[model samples]
Target: MSDILFTSSATAKNGRDGHVKSSDGMIDLDLVNPAENKEGKGSNPEQLFAAGYAACFDGALNLVASKKDKQIDSTTTAEVSFMKDKEDGGFKIGVTMNVEVQGVSPEDAEELVEAAHQFCPYSKATRGNIDVKLVPQAIE
Candidate 1:
């Protein structure tokens, strides 16, 4: 392991049908499978993953823009889908990140998004393991 920057810990009980709590007590929530969550009462793993990835990617996008001396306001939305895996007869997850960038040209926005995909930790982690689509839009 390289030099540790930080570590986050969370504990989950009863698999996908119970509860999860962070070690820092910042997160405490019920877990429900999306297929079983008819009333939308609790959070699912896919939703959590989407939130994390979106936030991370947005930060990375801002960082990349700053390095290029471009001031940009950006929002990233990560849509995560859980689907059946035909190869293994199991399940897999895919992501589509929609990024809206202001204060930049359309071409620059697209380039920044591409650079963020290469820089973001979450993107790097899921690069070869899953499918991720990046959509960049420039706003006036």
Candidate 2:
């Protein structure tokens, strides 16, 4: 029952070590698995997901700041780890978002980041499904 603003589709062949192409042909990247004996080099699903999530979260932070009538210069660094879920017997993702806001107090930056977590679609979708840690910092 939600209004769809936009949708993105991608096709991947050969699982983790393969090629991925988007429906819009904007993203066509070769994937390489880092778990192999050979050191293959290329992009991976986790990296892509982390990039997308970081950008989306930053956008959400900006939205919240705007609503609060505050001007913030911020940067979001997301570190995503892919690990084995011992309980689930499969792989899972863990996200740590390091957010730095310039010209803002640490308390205000923390508040903005918390509000962003509530507003970000990625955060909403991953809530309760993954472990996400938000670290807010203020830069002078």
Candidate closest to the true structure, highest lDDT: 1
Candidate 1: regions farther than 4 A off = none
lDDT of 1: 0.94
RMSD of each predicted structure: 0.8, 1.1
Q: Which regions in candidate 2 have their CA more than 4 angstroms from the true location?
A: none
Across residues 1-140, which tens digit of lDDT does each residue of candidate 1 receive? 78999999999999788898999999899988978667767888898899999999999999999999999999999999999999999999999999999999999999999999999999999999999999999999
lDDT of 2 at 113: 98
Q: Report the error of model 1 at residue 61, Å.
A: 0.4
- Each model's lDDT: 0.94, 0.93
Residues 1-140 of candidate 2 have per-residue lDDT tens digits of 78999888999999889999999999999999776624787889888999999999999999999999989999999999989999979999999999999868999999999999999999999999999999999999
